[model samples]
Target: MANARNLSTSSEPLNPKTFLSSIFDAAVAAADAKLTIRGHLPQKPKGRTVVVGAGKGAAQMAVAFEKAWDGPIDGLVITRYGYSAPTERIEIVESAHPVPDEAGLMGSRRLLEKVAGLTDDDLVVALICGGGSALLPSPAPGISLADEIAVNQALLASGAPIAAMNTIRKHISTIKGGRLAAVAWPAKVVSLVVSDIPGDNLALVASGPTVPDTGSRADALAAIAAYGMKFPDAVMAHINSRAATAPDPADEKFARNEVYLIASASVSLEAAAADSRRQGIEAVILSDALEGEAREVGSVHAAIAREVATRNRPFTKPVLILSGGETTVTLRAKGKGGRNSEFLLAFAIGIDGLNGINALAADTDGIDGSESNAGAFCDGSTVARMRAVGVDAKAMLAGNNAWTAFKAVGDLFVTGPTGTNVNDLRAILVR
Candidate 1:
């Protein structure tokens, strides 16, 4: 990683909007594949060096790898629609994310076939990141892509954490759970991973196509039962069977593989903090791996900010409180809000009339949930502004419709397809 420069030390006053937005941008840029992929590249092999990956950022990872490698390289990667990048040797295939599609099925089949019959001298560079699980949907034998889609839908709506969801995904998929690595056999597979999992678990990022699996079909079944996720009878039988199990971690095929976490929410949070300090404000990183229900997490954060605003107890006044992680939203209604928007909605209502408190919550990947906006911004007057537009802020949150409320109040943060994913970056500036 490169050094974080002190951007400014002047005595000028900070603009809350501009400063908070910069903190977000700094967090996202810190995890960009262009900056994070250079040093992590493996030593070129004497034989072929093929790249295969799938994620929202896989296209950009391919571009960076091409620029960094001196030897010839060619392969394929699957990225979400509208997140594709131009590359000469590597083919960038656009696919659906958070849900697999026909394009992903075809692309995933091509990706799996790219590494066939590799020798010991050949290298398989796997550029893994967030959203790879849904972007590459090569279903297991005797299962249809529709079956996998049903599983993904249930997992998403079940509000399972990345691990639980991916546990299920790995057990039923063809390319995931290190099966891709197993296929390469004698070839050394070095994975350059940009982690989006809260705890930096490489195996769960995009279901870890190139990494080993420590989970099994039994875990997936337990997750399904715990969440009360109903599936087709055929699907249930498939999970109950042993054939759905992933390759064992002790399998010799993984002996030569390497995994590197080049970028993550922790590093980005520190980068945001460094940028905050350079702008003459104290930045406190609350945590990098917080996990809970979305609105509940927002309420707790709002309480902290309120306490800071009223009484300077924790760390004194004028502090930028930062956090990063994957927060889940258990769906009770078919609402239009993602986890970040839901978090901001609850937070806005909690600190409705408080002054000098402004915050921005956004996914670093430039998409919050399935919404077009990255996230929504909130401040002391956010609820009041929503009322001005006749939006009942609390009711919106109750209905899980924070995205609509944010849009109605004109505070939706927009940064389309940032070519990276490090999960969510949230900043609360208390003045």
Candidate 2:
């Protein structure tokens, strides 16, 4: 699994409303949102069943588990602020994400301490996802909270892919990189993961707090050096000391751990394709692991959709195309948009008012790159709309201001945290 930063962009034909809804359905299905995990609980573990989790989806997953389970369960979870949901058994703690904060550090400590001293009979259900690496930042020995915060900021600005960012994070933290499970040793660790990374490498999601890490301290150091990052004396010292003796998995005792990838971008894309089929549209899934620059992929998708619409060569008219994966924006311009918005903007520019073609691009979590809107909607009329408002699509794209441009035309689609994250979903419908 790679970090969110490694996501690449690719495109296909999609319809605004139908495509958006289909994508949403696929994300929900991939997350197995309706299949509350508690339904699979092993009959109230012989000992206490403690629910400990961290991520943007942690609170919602905890709530779902609570709703499905029958016995009295007690636990706590930390999630990105504004991503919390009501839960009776599990007390939801709000924390910062994409960047470490004091609350996250404190909460991480509390969760770590909470799971301490678990026996073989006890169980620790870990709900992990894309944002947990930053959501649960617990600095290792001698690394001050401030220092950890500084490193986190550096990593975010570095634009390194998710796997690389997480590699560094695993070494710097006390809970990540299988340390959490190591701490809760002897107890069975049931990790329910909503994978956000390509290839679904379990060890990389959320820094593999519950899963065993195949990476090492050397790998972490390599990532830091690759980015040319400098750390404080204390942080550097810790890294130097552990450089040769990265936390040893064999030394730790979390052998009973089991991880389940409950959701993924591939699964979401398949579900979306199925939804399109239900609508009597010949839907095709382009790729679930598509990566690279967003705008460029948007142009390619537009080209394919245009071909199918005009000549009915590759895919006949009345076809729906779907794709799901995270995309990255290099951010050469001081743009106020996420990759999805940028993709939509570029797609609109490429189509140039191709009648009967519509599309939608959205991040599954309903939030795109620190912005309020999930993504955006585009159609044959999109170019005309921008022209009417005197909005130059090319200029807006160059400025990375697709969010603002879409907002002006009231085409911004906001879903307020859809309670799950499966990267991004793009759908194009040619009718």
Candidate 3:
């Protein structure tokens, strides 16, 4: 991996917005496939090298692998629509995310076919990341694509954590869990993952397409039941069928397989912290594994920031409080916003115009929920500025319309598709 020191640091006399952006960029850079993947790439195989993957970062990882590889490599990878990276050898296909589509279904079937005939000498390099669960959709037999999409929509709005959502996903899909790796049995499989889950659980990342699934069908059904997810009869039946069981962990086929976390939320959080210190800011990483309701987490962080800004109990001024991990947003209003936006709005309300505090909350993949904006930003002036415009911050948050509120206030942070995903990056600058 490239040294974090080589990354660009925040300029002197730190401007909050610029400094925060720099920190985010550093975090994303630290997780970029081009920089971290080559070191983890396995030795070239004597037989054909087949690459297959699906995620927001899969296309980018494919590009990196193609560039670094010496032998002839051919494969297909699916990425979120508009998140495709330029690549020569590997085929990159665009597909829907957070919901499955026909494109993903076709691509996933083709990916499985590509590795089906591979021999023990052949190599299967699987690039997996945050959105793969939805990007590589192969509905289990007897389940329709529409049925799978409905289940996914319910899971997303159910406010379930990524792990739970993925558990349900793996049980209903033919490609997720350990099924994908099982199909490529006898061929050496190497999975390179960019983790976007809390605790970096290999089985939860992208629903563990290339690793053994530790979760059981009962676990998946329990998640569905917990979320009160109503799936079609066919979908439910498929989940209950014997075919739904994933490959067992003790399977010898997986003995030759390897899973490597090329980048993760913790690594990116540390990179952000390192950059902050370089700028002479006291950096404290609260947690890289935080998980909870978005608004609730935001309120708690706001309290911490408020104390630091006013009492300076935890740290002195010019402190950057950082955290990484995924947060959930339960849908109450039919509002157009993601977890990050919701978090920022709640945070803004919690701070309530306390001065000298600025913050940024964003998904590292450059998309928050289903919105175009990566996330939103707020400083001391946010609440007052919204009030000045006759906008009720509380009402907007109540309606779960943080994106619209942030858009009205011109505070949306828009970094187009950052070819990676390490979950969320949140920073509060106390000055």
Per-residue CA lDDT of candidate 1, range 125-225, in tens? 99999999999898887788999899888888887788888998888888999999999888999999999999999999999898977887878889998
Off by over 4 Å in 3: 1-13
The predicted structure with the larger lDDT, 2 or 3, is 3
Task: Give all candidates' CA lDDT scores.
Answer: 0.90, 0.79, 0.89
- What TM-score does candidate 3 get on C-alpha atoms? 0.96
Model 1 has an lDDT value of: 0.90
Please list the residue runs of candidate 2 whose C-alpha ends up more than 4 Å from where it truly belongs after superposition. Answer: 1-19, 36-39, 221-252
Higher-TM-score candidate among 1 and 2? 1
Candidate 3: 10-residue stretch with minimal lDDT: 1-10
TM-score of each: 0.96, 0.88, 0.96
- Where model 1 places Cα greater than 4 Å from the true spot, the runs are 1-13
Model 1 steric clash pairs: none
